[model samples]
Target: MDWDKLRIFHAVADAGSLTHAGDVLHLSQSAVSRQIRALEESLETTLFHRHARGLILTEQGELLFDATQAMSKRLDAASARIRDTEEEVFGNLRVTTTIGFGSIWLAPRLRKLYANYPDLSIDLMLEERVLDLPMREADIAIRMKEPSQADLVRKRLMDIRMQLFASPAYIEANGMPRRMKDMTQHRLICQAQGATQVSAGAMLVRELMTYAVERTLTVNNYFGVLQSVVSDLGIGVLPDYLQQDFPQLVRVLPEVESNEVPVFLAFPEELRGSRRVQAFRDFVVEEVVAYRRARQIAAQ
Candidate 1:
């Protein structure tokens, strides 16, 4: 059987009409019709029944459609693997990551990656919104949440810990809260976009507030919130790793609630065996592991 004719038949069956299939495939309507007819003739079975509304798939057509769907996916995977092997690690890689991490962490390391692989090109897309990997919106993704799709291969890179912190000026201005109830007298900064008020910081504050005092001030970005706290505007929760950047900032509570956000690198499962994808994945894992270890030693 001609694969081209089968491909055309699959498109028409999926679209429900030759005209619609032609529009999708960027082929002439007549060409689509011809291909479908040829496919039906080769199979010696009527795959679709013509109706006033459109074409309806026969029972045989449904079975064929299922088989073709699997076949098409396998073919695409095989083709991608072959291309990856034949070509150098010189193609453009589309990477999607969170804005803060992309800018502060990944961007700096990417220069070394480029220096190592001079032929490789990268397109970094930094956004808060998660892109669809199955839809091919991005080639690779660095995300806090692990993707649930079975078609994706995910590797946990690191654990990011959240901590409550405030500048010395803010602490001095409001007076240090020895207990939770004392926080009510001081201002608190929180993220507006977050759904729950019970963040790691909030939980610690609320717990302390139960015995001491409490108050609140919500904001969006961590950097902005930290800046406000530094200027004696209020106190907020920030990533523990970020404290090194602001020497003036101090951990608010000695016994604050801490939670680890798992950082992951994800790619389509089909591309897991591809040479280029594997190479990049290995490089990224190595870099992140080294960075995490160095950070641990520094903290010690």
Candidate 2:
């Protein structure tokens, strides 16, 4: 197969117009069209459906596009790994984690990481969706549950539990609930049961709702719940780690909390030698250790 033709085909298929694709590829429209024609003749099949507006991929084209897309991703992965020299850890490191953890816990600590590696560029992807680490959908992932995907090098970072919390002002005004059943007296803030959150956190919300509190406020994520709680709107169900960051938030009904959720940091096994991966992993591990120490001291 001709790599140049395939590359041109990929560009044409991606852009849906020879002119647009050629503009991107720095080739004339006729030259791009010639390559596509040569590619089709070599493959003995039409790859596109010619139309007035733009080109649409044929079935064969779709298959080829899929292959080309995978190839591109693999090439990108290889390029990234090659740039990850042992002497320096300075390049784009795509980090994926849950929105709650990314925004609340990991993001704030990134200031220190930046201070240490001033030249490092980070692409932080905050979402509940599990990205394909093996396929290079993302470079690194910090997930609540263990990644069952093969070919991933995973390390348990820590454990977290969902607990009830409220602002001190809210607690002082509404009085703290000493027991799960006492929650009926105040507004209960939490993530909706259907929201994309860890199973343990969802289960906690489900169990709490079984008490049938008189009033309730359900948000899509912990961030929103935390905002409501801090605004003194109500008590919120949030991860225990938040207490370390927001000390003013008072824990409520500590006895009623979610089961432990294990946090893991993972990257493709192929990235074991990647300097960027090692740097980020070490930074996170150090931060978690420091966080644990701070909490231990606070407890005493």
Candidate 3:
């Protein structure tokens, strides 16, 4: 069976029209029709029933479509693996990560990855939105939360602890909050990005709001929130490691709930066995683990 013809058939069946399928496949309408015809002839079965409105898949076509979709994914994965063997782990790696983590953490570490593998190309995209891996939007993703889907392969990278912090100047001017209840009297900055876990910020805000405490300001990104807190805009919660960089910043409440934010390294399950993907994944995991251990020892 011609894989190309099967691919064309799958596209047409999915699109429900030859014109739309052609548009998707970047082929002419007639070309799409020819490929579908060839596929049907090869299979010796009528795949689609033609109607006045458009094309509809037959019973046999429906079954074939299910099988073809799975086959296409497997074939694509196989092709990527084969290419990896020939190309020496040299391809554009599209990585998705959050703004703060990408800047302060991954960006710096990526230098080492480049140093070890000069041929490897990287396109690092930092955003709050999660990119779809199955759609080929991203080759790898570093997210705060683990993906629950069985089709994705996820590994827990680290446990990020959140702490409520403020600048010394702000605490001096506004008076330090000795208790969570005292937080109500002062202004607090909130993140526009919703927290998936009960981090310090989320916990503080939830408690404050439950008691009808007023929040001063809200920002979209963590970097922006951190900046606001640094400039003494208002007290806000931030990651523990982030405070090490700035001497002026001090933890506001040391007794806040400790939430372990599990960072994950995830990729499509289909690409798990690919040599290049496997190699890069292993390298990143090792680097992150070593970095975490070094940080622990330094803190001690």
Candidate 4:
């Protein structure tokens, strides 16, 4: 089999568009099309079913893609091992996490990581959808819940909970709810039940909705909910970790909270020897330790 042709085919299959594949491969669309044609002729089979919308992989294409995907993963594993040779960490590191956690917590502390490794490029993907680490969709993931995927090296970062909070101004104006039933007197700002969120967080919001509050504001993510709460919109169901940065938010009905949600940092087994991953993991661990120690001191 032609390795060059296979590489082009893999890129087209991964991108599902000749133009996109060409752009990524730094070749013209015509050049990419010619290469695909040659590969199809050499294999004596149609790899992709051409359509107006985009290309779809045929059975033959799927088979080839599967092999290519495995090869890609192995190459990545080898690359990671090679990167462990030097103490210097300088390369693109793709990290994924929830929007709330990334924007509220992780993004603020990234300066230190950059300071330590000035040449490092960090791509922070903040979304609720969990990217497949093993598939190389993301190099590392900080998830709100324990990852169940196999062949992942995981670490528990901390325990988080969904609790009620409102800005001081909002609480002063609306009056804090003393009981669950009292929530009916105030507007409840939360991530809508329909939004993509952790099961535990969704359950917490769902339980809050059961109170049949007359006025409510439902946003898609915690960041939006927090924004509304801080603007004096209403009481928000938010993660406890937010309190560290948003000290102006006052806890409401402290007794009413969700079961603990475990925050975890995870990476593919392939990245076990990656210096970039090691650097990020150590930085996060150190930050978490300092955060916990500070919290304990505040309590004391």
Off by over 4 Å in 3: 1-79, 193-201, 244-248
Which regions of candidate 2 are displaced past 4 Å?
16-20, 28-30, 50-55
For each candidate, give its TM-score against the true structure. 0.61, 0.93, 0.67, 0.91
Candidate 2: clashing residue pairs, number? 0
Which 10 consecutive positions of candidate 3 have the poorest summed lDDT?
A: 192-201
Per-residue lDDT of model 3, residues 262-282, tens digit only:
889999977876666776787
Per-candidate clashes, comma-separated? 13, 0, 0, 0
RMSD value for candidate 3: 5.5
TM-score rank order: 2, 4, 3, 1
- Worst lDDT run of 10 residues, candidate 2, spans 205-214
Off by over 4 Å in 4: 15-20, 28-30, 51-54
Q: Report every candidate's CA lDDT.
A: 0.74, 0.93, 0.78, 0.90
State the local distance difference test value for candidate 4. 0.90
Report how far residue 48 has shifted in candidate 4, in Å: 2.9
Name the better of 3 and 4 by lDDT.
4
lDDT per residue, candidate 1, 1-300, as tens digits? Answer: 788888888899888998999999999999988888888888899999998899999999999998787677667556667777554676667789876567656777777787777877788998767887765667789887788878899999877766677878777777776765566777777555353322454455455446543456666555566667777877676666564446568787767655667788998977776666776788888887787777777779
Best by TM-score: 2
Q: What order do candidates take by lDDT, descending?
A: 2, 4, 3, 1
RMSD of 2: 1.9
